[model samples]
Target: MFLEVGGNRSTRRKPTVTRENMQTHQRDREMLIWSNPGVEPTTSLLGSQSSNHLATMQSVMYELMSELNDRSEDLERQMLSLEQRVEQLTAGFNALPAHLSATLSAQHAALVHLLRERDSRDYHRAAGGGGASDAGAVVAVVPLSPASPLTHIPSLQLLRYKLPLLRKRPPQCQL
Candidate 1:
């Protein structure tokens, strides 16, 4: 059997037609995959589909960000309102009674004096207008026994001194 080089049916030398036909075939195959969506595609087609999916996801993210921006504006307005209410409460606190203000100032001054006495150990020097004193200035006067009678009293003292004082006891039996 001899194979003929030239076809006898059609003698068309159109290169553009062949290219167009190939492009159309590719488009048809892509359309089939796109329409049927369950069918997986080759690498090139998969890449295009992935890029399209990414673009769709990006647009959805933008829409969500826009919605969040609107909510943020409303939250900012609410925060400003809360701040104004706090300012009003602070102004009311500023209008407290003069006695209360005086008490607070006296307590603050006492606290400062105590803290200075604790840190410096020079209360007399401070009172002497920064004079060099011979002795160490004693500031604090702590009690010798800080524990209460309930926890620290001797058992004999508790029975003899405290219990008899609290309740009237019967006459002691002469053993």
Candidate 2:
């Protein structure tokens, strides 16, 4: 290549690279590679050290993968438990109306039985209690259940008569 002097091209020779200049350039390149962490040096520098760093990176990656798998399994177990609880709640909710209907049916049966007993007794009283309706009628009307609506009548006679007849108690069930 020609040399440019004062914006004019001149016929001249290019400088030759000496051995010392080549060595200095090599040293500068190596120094640059060492100073910058982004540059990976050649394995010719330290083969054992590079191998050690690779091994350490692999071990750390394995540990992280193992921990991730363990956490994922724990989360799956928790989700399964929550799903089972939800199923139990749904089952209980679905059965609520049936249970309520059964309980109400039992209470209705008891009420009907009480009404029939009261009607029978009133019929008997109207029929003159078989010719002995005064004290005998009072005694007969005293043995009904304490929970009977007949026992809560707003009357002058049957108000104090919760001990006339012992009827069968209604069936009870737990919720």
Candidate 3:
């Protein structure tokens, strides 16, 4: 039998329909499973594109993770700083009343000492000079002994101690 060459009606030399030739024709028409430079890029192109997509996704995930870790660390630092500030404020609040009490107690003691010194001076001047002229004058005695009960007693106890013993007359007001 003869075969048409190039779809021209001209018949070429008689050709043999061999089994190997038929298999080669079928192979050309079917899909190729392997890579070939002559064929369009199908499987290789898809595989490479998928690999690129996976790499991009991994980079994005890494960036997100890094950002999250940084934010968490920043929050932890802020929490620690806030806790320290709270502690300082609490300590200051707790100490304020005690500090005020001590300061007031010291002032009261100093005032009581001054009053005693003034009375002692007035009494001596009155007995020596005369009463009316000595009434306005004031004096001070420094460095009372540590062993003195007058120096060591609490203000409440000192106020209760008999001031009449040191003065000629009684005070107008009493605790």
Best of the candidates, lDDT: 3
- Among residues 3 or more apart in sequence or in different chains, the pairs in candidate 1 whose N, CA or C atoms overlap within 3 Å are none
119 in model 1: Cα distance from truth in Å?
Answer: 56
lDDT of 3 at 34: 41
Clashing pairs in 3: none
Positional deviation of residue 1's Cα in model 2 after best superposition, in angstroms: 36
Compared with the true structure, what per-residue lDDT tens digits does model 2 show for residues 119-153? 56766877864543232344322333333434243
lDDT of each: 0.54, 0.57, 0.60
TM of each candidate vs. truth:
0.33, 0.47, 0.47
The sequence of per-residue lDDT tens digits that candidate 1 reaches over residues 1-175 is 2233457553545344466788888998889789768765676678798999999999999999999999999999999999999999988776645445454444434533544443345546477556532221222222222222223334322233333332222233111
User: How many backbone clashes are present in model 2?
Assistant: 7
TM-score ranking, high to low:
3, 2, 1
Candidate 3 — worst ten consecutive residues by lDDT sum? 132-141
What are the RMSDs of all candidates, in order? 21.3, 13.2, 13.9
Better of 1 and 2 by lDDT: 2
> What are the runs in model 1 whose C-alpha is more than 4 Å off?
1-41, 98-175
